[model samples]
Target: MKIVIISLLAISLHLTNSQITSGIVSDFVRTNLIGYPLIHEPKTWIFDPDVALKRRKQFVDLHGDKGEKLIERLGLGIDGNYEERLAEQRKRDEGHLGGLNAHLP
Candidate 1:
């Protein structure tokens, strides 16, 4: 009986720890991956641009430009030049779509 109780307690603790670890990982991804992109280029997503910008500002205020440095390290482009890159992406997208339009009536 004592052995069974100890095993059950161990199992419970393991499960609890797993839950905490998973929560931390999810929060990390949400903040770093989803939040960062939304903040970096609000034009791409349909969410309120102001909210993204505000969250980005909050992140910067907290993290002190680490996000921008990470983006640069990843070779994604500079932080402040999102508009230029976005415009270039739009032009590239339009160019690809333009060829398809020529095929239609």
Candidate 2:
């Protein structure tokens, strides 16, 4: 019984060691040999601008005037054209394509 337990433990240790070594080797190859891993790439920021704009549009749409008022509270536009930005947001909100019936009406 003791011999069986010891054998099982030795096998488990071998497997765990192999797994750790394989993980280290794969990570090294991915970063150094295979150009780069996806998480380490720099161009991730510039890949999708429209998705970001769409998210901002959704936020302004949901919060409405209350949202604009909150932006003013944040003291972002003490002298700059806040009203112009608000108008631009309004235009964007209105221009979003809603439904198939929109074209018919």
Candidate 3:
């Protein structure tokens, strides 16, 4: 009976710790992505493409391949081809701006 009680107590503590850690990590990620005033205005300061690319590079440098896998698991649409995505976005934006310029003058 004592062994069983000890086991249950350990399991409860482990579960509580896991929950707390998960909550902290979720909050940190949300704060980094959305900024502090998320409840009021939802300002996405770190949501810019350049900022995201920089952060991605830093993450990859710090965590190596595991970082890439983590990013993939996060379902952020970054499938380890950040450069390709950035290039594509740049081309698209330039094309759009070029079209606008053509029509302006």
Candidate 4:
């Protein structure tokens, strides 16, 4: 098929013209792995989360209590005590996990 030929051509060209760079890998990450554009004009996930999240708080809202474990599983941030953070956040939210609203006290 024409699509296959195009892919083969692209791969061949890529191999000849460039070494494996982060941007090239980032392009693949953004395109196929994560399916999210390079937000902030940068940053890409190495593997697919397989879900769409438009806003930061949508993470917990989408996954519920499992959200904390999900962050651990996905390596979403620096290695730290995520469970502790969640517990603290819950106390602040009165045991509810919701989106942030800086305007509210």
Root-mean-square deviation per candidate: 18.5, 16.5, 20.1, 17.4
How many pairs of residues collide in model 3? 0
Which scores better on TM-score, 1 or 2? 2
Question: Which parts of model 3 are misplaced by more than 4 Å?
Answer: 1-76, 98-105
Q: Clash totals for all models, in order? A: 0, 0, 0, 0
- Please give, for residues 1-105, the per-residue lDDT of candidate 3 as tens digits: 686557556655676687875665556546864666647674555456687667876788766756655653454355687767656656666846633755566
Show the lowest summed lDDT stretch of 10 residues, model 2.
95-104
Pairs of residues at least 3 apart in sequence or in different chains that clash in candidate 3: none
lDDT of each: 0.63, 0.62, 0.62, 0.60
lDDT by residue (29-94, candidate 4, tens digit) is: 577657865444665668756444545467666655567667544543556776776676566767
- TM-scores for all candidates? 0.20, 0.22, 0.21, 0.21
Model 1 is weakest, by summed lDDT over 10 consecutive residues, at: 68-77
**What is the Cα-based lDDT of residue 87 in candidate 4?**
70
Top lDDT hit = 1
For TM-score, the strongest prediction is 2
Winner of 2 and 4 under TM-score: 2
Span of ten consecutive residues with least summed lDDT in model 3 = 68-77
